[model samples]
Target: MMNDRNVVPERRFSADDSISVVETATGKRVDRRDFLRLTGMGAGALAAPALLSGGRSVAEAAEVSGTVPNLLRNGTYPVGLWVAPPPGETTVARYAEIADAGFTFVTGIDGCGGFCPPGETATAENAALLDAAAANDLDAIVYDHRISNIQNHPSEQWRDVIESILGEYQDFPAFAGFDIRDEPNASAFAQIGGINDILGQLDPGVLGYVNLFPTYASADMLGTPTYQEHLARYVSEARPDFISFDHYMLVGARPTIREDYFYNWVLVRNQALQAGLPSWVFILACEHYGYRLPTDEELLWQVNVSLAYGCKGIQYFTYWTPPLPGFHEALVTVDGQLTPLYYAAKRINNNYLQPVGKQLLPLTSESVAHFGEAQPSMGVEVFSGDEWVDSASGSAAILSRFHDPKRPNQRWLLVANREFESTANTTLTLHHTISAMFEFDTSERRYVPLEKAEPTGPATLAVHLEPGEAKLYRLHANQGD
Candidate 1:
């Protein structure tokens, strides 16, 4: 049962046939090919790939070295914000507020610069931004809006601009990437690819940032027949180190969320899985236009949902509380006061996201399935091999299966409560006997053994989760069962 406090009125979700999900019962389908794909092609054969960067596969390289790695420490995943430039002068005081909010990187609002001086003036401006970021324990994804205008020009001119910006800021340890463009269509892929080529030649370590349009865009807007096709073309042409995009649909006075919300994730998850690329998604942190302030659950919905789909990082649409009107609901206010959303974000990020993210980064996503009322139409795997498993019926949950390439026998499960405004009691039932299983404790920040259970008939692991909360489990197999 849901706590009615913030329960959004029951609404029908959009049906996207391209990404499949099926009801719990198997009777309707004759052959469950898609269902099997959604689960696993039978466990041991599953191979989870590493995130690719600069055309190099992290899984392969990291495994060969035989050392554990973290996304933050390794500088792979960036949980961050879209910040406006400093006010008037080049001061990083805002960065302290950004750092205080627990964001790792600060990306500009537009290409080159946003709310800052133009041209060579930006060179000096970004220097201050990066300096402040590093001093305050944050990273800077330098945005050079200047490059956008001149990328179409001759190589010499473009090179001069790209080099000028990179030259001024590349040495800063806080420098993460150059925000090359935002919400680009297929027409810009070739151009983006050309710019990325220059970036590679200059500094392969830096990410060439170009955020894509969400699935809701029209074919004309995307410059491709379908949204997936748009992503495919960009991946093929741009050779980006990673992919990012934003879609703000949690709207209306009653807080109506668009069905395309989850659909957009499917597109990103499918593509990222195939490309072995990391993915970043943005959530609406501020109120503007028709969209109002998001409840804590709404914020968790985007962040946790992204994690379920294997998103490596998350970003807030605005962290600095832009000077625009009606945008007061963000983490920080225009006057730098903390809003309730800020504290909510802090708890989710520090207490939940940071711990889980650090733990899940090294493990590659093998498969994902959903349960409860809003389940993905494909199907969730409650049973595998001779073992039959069942989750609490009617509890909306997202179950993600992951595997460490180095430890193939070991497996992981990340269960997320999908209902944005309700608490879910999920009982995971396994019909077949197992040696042992454990749950990851985010609070203590370690795995604690779950009391061993024998299958008198079925073994059950029950968990209670707050709205938009998640839990991770580890299953251990005993030999010669």
Candidate 2:
């Protein structure tokens, strides 16, 4: 039987759909596809093109020459944050916090509600924010308030607003793209074609960002699908290159809501997949609407869970905490302090994310197998510099993404953890004999030995994770195969 501790409550499948439970005492197994259906990843989860990056070492170049290439051509995995100003200052200390916290990008308002400094001043203020971010080696993106409800205007008015915003950022490099409409309704999506029509006329290369609500009411109620279905249909037709999603499981009194969170994200990912779009996820950073701040374990669970499922980019809903009397539970405090959430984020970024991105930057996401544990999801057959390592096994294992960054003979395998625990004892027993080194957990980010007990036998690898962690291992083809 799966350990109760590993079985997160909310996403738990019904009794009938339970998977094989090996009674620890009797050594007997029970058959449960219903359980697998509840947890089993459909075939769609397992498909992705893999390739290599432009920069490759000499040994890596000698491996496999060509394979599946990633849809996202180049760049490291980007860690992003929502931009908001401090309560009193046009200048916020969080800009520095983002850098200290080891982030790659920060997104913020150009000045919303007119309370912000006017025109050029606002642009300069935003520019200064970017300048601050750059000092820390972080990129910045601009976000305007909800466009769909701008003046609660009619469709034409909304289209004009979108066009106007796109026009403003046409020449701005510091500005990535507008978030478009935050949590837009069906009307907004249906009218999206027109909005894009306006944007195309103004700035053809700008991206249209959409953050959709988790659930929605449909005409048929019972037969009506969830909002994700609608989102998928819209994105597939719209064909936006990158899609963003917001997951707020803690919004209500759902104490055990973690399981539903991944499913909700997958719902939108399915939409992105059908649309042939790449996806990014926004994880909750603040305690919203009575929702408590996430515990360290829960936070780590969310990050590793996301990487397992295939989120190229990870975004924190709010990096600069909003003040008290409203949203008090924040990832970072108003005093520019690091909360439990902040440290959790640091541990994840420092120990896991960056190192893994360095190794896996060459691979593409090839296929997936999302079953076996509480947060069960795995992507298999990714190439690490042209070396294909077998998929992870056991209840919870590594989530893989493969890529070839235009470097003909090189590839990368982005292997991330599937569970939240700071340490994992699972081993990858490959069919081929090879020696590899991985940077694993605790004190002084050092390289550890990958012990090989035999010459021709499968390699045994054990890892120690620091909460929401990730690591990369590079192996030559002969060593890996």
Candidate 3:
């Protein structure tokens, strides 16, 4: 466990509102302005969160002693990676990289296929995977042992397979659950749901994992009148514990981005919320099948947009590089070298996703609003320009509203930059007085105070958001001074 006192010393603001940051090596005081500029705070506004433990923020680290003390213990949010570990490399370091990046869970197999070395029994493979996961206090989603497409397979056979896998590996402390299938159509739900129920009966904690197809799936392939209908049928038949889906909306194709990209999120999010189930969505980690490689801003946009919709979990499509053609440049290369994305992923997860995801797990998303004409899901209302002091900054952005039962009557706002190519400087003039405002310190995994708005006639909060960056503000008029 990290000791808070040793990390972030309290900030002492200078007369000019320039805060002091102590340099770790020499104990020299660095001006906050210069520190932010150097860290590209204005460029991305990532500095809003006190980069705490394991990432960048000393002050945030000082505050939240153990954001997650036991790695996978306290967290209810499930952050999973579709691992593509290099063939023949099952070292502790390999798995440790996943854990160190703040992912709480790992899928035992790779993308586009199951475990390689087809002769390897899923049971043995899962146990070995568990060994790696356990070493880092992470969990593994048991994948196919020998059976393939068990979800589409006959229900009785699927049960037998699920039972066999669980019987042999369910005892492992690191076993998270079994991956039944990926992107199942509506017709397969009844059988898969039965298998899910059986898997649950075998061990209640083990999830019946089945990721759904996104709205991008053709209407005919969906087998339902609409994508929404497709999901409705799944929930009714499959009886899943939670909902999950994958949409690679960042394809820089004809539209430059998927037209239904934002729509997919809203649809799945609403469906999951209505069913009273938490949902998980995947962000693209590799370029393939016409999807271009993502820049850092694009990556952040994917995550922030998901978070804005109140997703309970964030799943990366690929962690290790896939050996398949066209699917290249994963966080780790097929040859076992680290890719640049590996480090960037490390920063985003530890610095933002994991911490914020954990914090929002229990809260429910009440509503989502998009600012400007470019974003927001289809049919959703866009924020009017009159609502803010200046609309130019947030002309294209995401505004998510949430309700936390733990703090009755309290609401939270998550503001995100819509575009991935530049920064957004938004001056928000609240229609009402906000009690307090704070930025979630990803490093500390706790809420740190934001300076109070100047006492102008209208309470205005000047926000500087980097491309795809998000600012979380807590509203509590009752606690206002």
TM-score of 2: 0.64
Per-residue lDDT, model 2, residue 84, is 46
Instruction: Itemize residue pairs with steric clashes in candidate 3.
Output: 8-58, 44-466, 51-57, 52-57, 52-443, 122-145
Evaluated against the true structure, the overall lDDT of model 2 is 0.48
Per-model clash counts, in order, read 12, 28, 6
Return whichever of 1 and 2 wins on TM-score.
1
Residue ranges of candidate 3 with Cα displaced over 4 Å: 1-76, 110-122, 145-164, 253-255, 374-377, 384-394, 456-458, 478-481
- Return the TM-score for each candidate structure: 0.78, 0.64, 0.77
Per-residue lDDT tens digits of candidate 3, residues 167-187? 555456676666766666577
2 against 3, candidate with superior lDDT: 3
Root-mean-square deviation (CA) per prediction:
13.8, 15.0, 17.4
All candidates' lDDT scores? Answer: 0.63, 0.48, 0.64
Tens-place lDDT digits, model 1, residues 161-216 = 67655655545767767776666657778878888877666656567787777766
C-alpha lDDT of residue 75 in model 2: 68
Candidate 2 or 1, higher lDDT: 1
Best by TM-score: 1
Error of model 1, residue 205, in angstroms: 1.1
